[model samples]
Target: MAQQLDNDLQFEDRFHRKFYYLRLSVTDVCNFKCTYCLPDGYKPTEKKKPSFLTLNEIERVTRAFAECGTSKVRITGGEPSLRRDYTDIIRIVAAQPGITKVATTTNGYRMEKNVKEWREAGLTHINVSVDSLDPKMFYQITGENMFHKVMSGIDAAFDAGFEQVKINTVLLKNQNSQELPKFLAWIKTRPIQLRFIELMQTGEMDLLFQKHHVSGVSIRNHLIANGWLLKINGKNDGPAQVFCHPDYMGEIGLIMPYEKDFCQSCNRLRVSAKGKLHLCLFGDHGVELRDLLSADEQRTELISRIQGGLKEKAVSHFLDAGNTGMTPNLASIGG
Candidate 1:
C-alpha cells in the first residue's frame, strides 16, 4: 500500500494540480438582492437559520486544510463583512501555521467600517464586486442605492493598506456593457485592478442569462474597437486574463468562464459556510465535512476527505453545455 502522506503533505494530480487554495464561505446572509443573484423582493429562507461554522470550527477546518498543504484561504459570503464576528475569524485563520495568505471577497457595502479592522487582523487582499459605476444602474443591479457607500468603502480599503485591491464587474449585455470603457478608464485613475467578468449562470442569474447572454469575447472586441490596446500578460491559472494599457498604471482583466473553460487547470477547492467540501463550482454534490469534524475521528480523516475530493475532481465543468448541478448562489459558494 502507498505510504500515507503526512497530514501536511500537499497533494496534486498527474497534471501538478496544487490544491493549496481554499475558498471558504463564512455565511450566506447578504444585505443586497442583486437582480442577477436574487429575485426582486426575494426573501431569505428563515426555516434554515443561516448556519455558520463557529470560529473554533472554522479554525479546525482551516488547520485541517493547512495540514493538507493549503497555503491560501479566502473568506467569502453573501457578504462576508455582514458577519458579526468576521474580524475574529479572519484573525484566527490568519494565525494558522501553514496558511500564508488570507483574503476576502465582499460586495463592499460595509467595507468602510471594517476594512481597517480587517487589515489589522491580517488580511492581505480584497476583491469587491462593483457591477456598475452609474448609481441608477448600481441600484438596479444590487436592489440597493448604496453606490456611494461602496465607493467610499473601496477608498477606505485602499487607505487601510490592502496590497492588492480588485474591483470585479460582471459584464451584462445592454445594461453595463456600454460603460465598459468608462469603467476601465475610471479604474485606471486609481490603484485598483479592474476585472470584467463574463456573467455566469448561478442562483437566479442562470435564468437571466438565457434571456440576455454576454460573453467575454464581445467585451474584448469592444475594448479593442475603442482603441484600448489589450494584451494577455498573466498565466492561465489566475482565472482573469490580465491586460495592460500603455498609458495606464492599473491593469484590466477579463474572466471568461463561459467562453473559455479553465477547469483543466483548476487547483482550488471550495468549502461552504456549513462545511461542505466542493470539488467543482458547478458540482451539485459535495462531501459533508461537518459530520466528519463533529465525529471523534482524528484530523487524519479530515485530510483524507479533502485529498479524496481532489483526486475525484472532474476534468471540467459542464457549464458550457448548460449543466451546472449546483443550486446555491455564488454568494453561497464564495465566488
Candidate 2:
C-alpha cells in the first residue's frame, strides 16, 4: 500500500496536473451510424478485422493505471456493450486494487435487459448517449429508430439502483440545438445529468464540422443567465464543467473543448482499444503499449513506459489552430 501511494504521487505531469482517471477504449466497432460520427455506418478495415485488447490485456493495463493513481476507469468503445464479455470486463476492472469507480459510456441499446447484470458486475456509474429528446430528431441524429427504447433503458438503469445516469448530447447546429427547453424539462424531475458536448472537428469531418458545429459556450451563457450555479469539480472528476439549479432535480455539464485553459485542469489519460497511449484526444499519434502488456511479469516495464510517455504530453491540444491530429473520426478511438 505504501509503495502504491508512492507511485500515485509520481503520476503528475510537468504542469503539476495529477491524473486519477483513465478512459479505456475496448473496441472500435460501433453499431450506430450517428451523422457526426459514422454517417455511412461502421466500416471494417480493408485488409482484415482489427484485433482489440483482450480481457487479460485490459486487466493488466488497468492494474498498472490503478497503481499509478488512476482511481476511476470509464470503459468506452464504438459501443462497449457489444463485447460478449462486457460484464466480465467490468468485473475485472472493478476488482483491480485502488480502482474505486468502474464506469462505462454506452449507447444504451442493451441497458433494459442487461443493466442489472452490469450493476451486479460492480459498475459504479454509466453514461448513455441520447443526442436528442425528440424521437424523430433522435432517429435522424443517431440513424437508429430506437430512441424510445434507449429511454426505456435509462429507466431500467435507475430501477437497477443507479443513483444518477448522465445523458450525452452532442450539440449540433440546426439538429438538436433548439431542444434545450425540452431537455431541461425532462431532467427537472429525474436524476439524469444532461451533458452537452460541442461537436469536435476530426480529420474526416471538416466540412460537416464547419456546417454543424455549435459552441457549448452559448449553452453555458444560457445556463448562467437562468440561475444555474456552476459547481467545482471533484479531485477525480472528468473534464465537464458541471452546473446545478436549486429547483431542478438534475444537473447540466458543459464540455467546451475550445474554452481557454480547458486542458489546464485535465486529470485523466486515455488508452486506445489497441493498447496505445494517447496523450490527448487531439494528439498527433499514440505510443504503443501492447507489446509491454503480453505477460504478467511485464507489468513493471508497462508502468515505466507509461510514466515515460507522460513526459511527452503537450500543454494543450491546440484545437483553435485547426489541428485535429490523426483522428479520422470519433469511432476510431471510441470517442
Candidate 3:
C-alpha cells in the first residue's frame, strides 16, 4: 500500500514524494571565479540587485517549511561565506522548530576564519569544494592561488568539532582527473569524507562539456584499477551514490547528475537567492515566493503556493539526454 501524504505537508505530490529538504542560496557573491561555475573575467550586472534575503524573511520562510515538515536545510551560494550576516542566517534557520539539520556548501576559502563562529551559531555540517590537491591545479580550476588557505580551513573545521565535513571535487577530464587517487589518499589523513561530483550542465561549465566531461563511471573504473574496491551501498535521496571503499578510512560519494538521473527519488525544492521557489534544479520557471511574501498573504496562502509548486514538479530533467541549455547557473540555484 502506498503511504498517503499528510495534509499539513505543504510540498507533497501525487507521486507520493514529500519535499523535506530546502537548498537556500543566501548570496551570489563569490571570491573564486571557478572555470566550471563562472566565466573568466565575469562582471556583475549593474542593476544593483539585492542578492541576499533579510534575516527575518529567511526565518519566516524557514519556519513555513518546518511547519510543512522540512527537516533539513542547506545554506548555499556563489559562496555563502561571502555574505556579511551569514552566521546570523545560520542561527535563524537552526533555531527553527523541527529542523534537524542545517548545513552549508562553501568554497572553503573563508572557513578557517569563520569556522568557530559557524559552529557556535549551530551549523551542523559543512561541505567544502576542493577540486585539486596540487596547488597549481587548484589555482587553475578555481582561478585562485589560495590552496593552503582552503586546506587550513578543512583542518579548522575539524578542530571546531564538526562531526562530518565533506570535501567535494568536480571531476573534469584532463584537469584534475589524474589527481583523484592522490586526493582520496590525502583526505584519509583528515576526518573529512570525499565526494567526487560528475560535472553537470550548469553555469559556464556547460559551455565546455564537450571538451571536459568526465563521467562517474570513468572515475569508478579508475578507482577500481587503482586497487580500491568500491561497493555501492545504496542511493542517497539526492543525486549522490554512496560508496564504501575497501580498507579506506573514509567513504567516497559519486554525484552523477549528468550520467545518471536520480530525479525519481528527488525530494528537494530550491529557494533561490532572490527568493523564488524552484521545484527542481533544472526548472527554468519558479513560483514567486518573494511576491507572495510582499502581498501580505496569510500563512495558509503561502503554504498553498508551495504545495501548488510541488504538484507542478516535473519528474526529471532533460539534460541527461544531451541537452545543455535547460538548467540555470548552479550559483543562482543552490547546489
Best by lDDT: 2
Per-residue accuracy of model 1 over 74-111 as CA lDDT, tens digit each = 89987887788999989999998877778888889889
lDDT of 3 by residue, 168-263 (tens): 998888999888668777756555678888777764565577778778887677666767654543211345665655566776778877554467
Could you tell me which 10 consecutive residues in candidate 1 have the lowest summed lDDT? 1-10
Cα lDDT of model 2 by residue, 149-242, tens digit: 8999999999999999999999999999999999999999999899999999998899989999989887899999999999999888888999
Q: Which residue runs of candidate 3 sit more than 4 Å off their true CA positions?
A: 1-10, 222-237, 294-297, 324-328
Q: Relative to the true structure, how large is the alpha-carbon lDDT of every model?
A: 0.78, 0.91, 0.77
lDDT score, candidate 3, position 126: 89
- TM per prediction: 0.90, 0.97, 0.90
* Least well predicted 10-residue stretch by lDDT in candidate 3: 229-238
Ranking by TM-score: 2, 3, 1
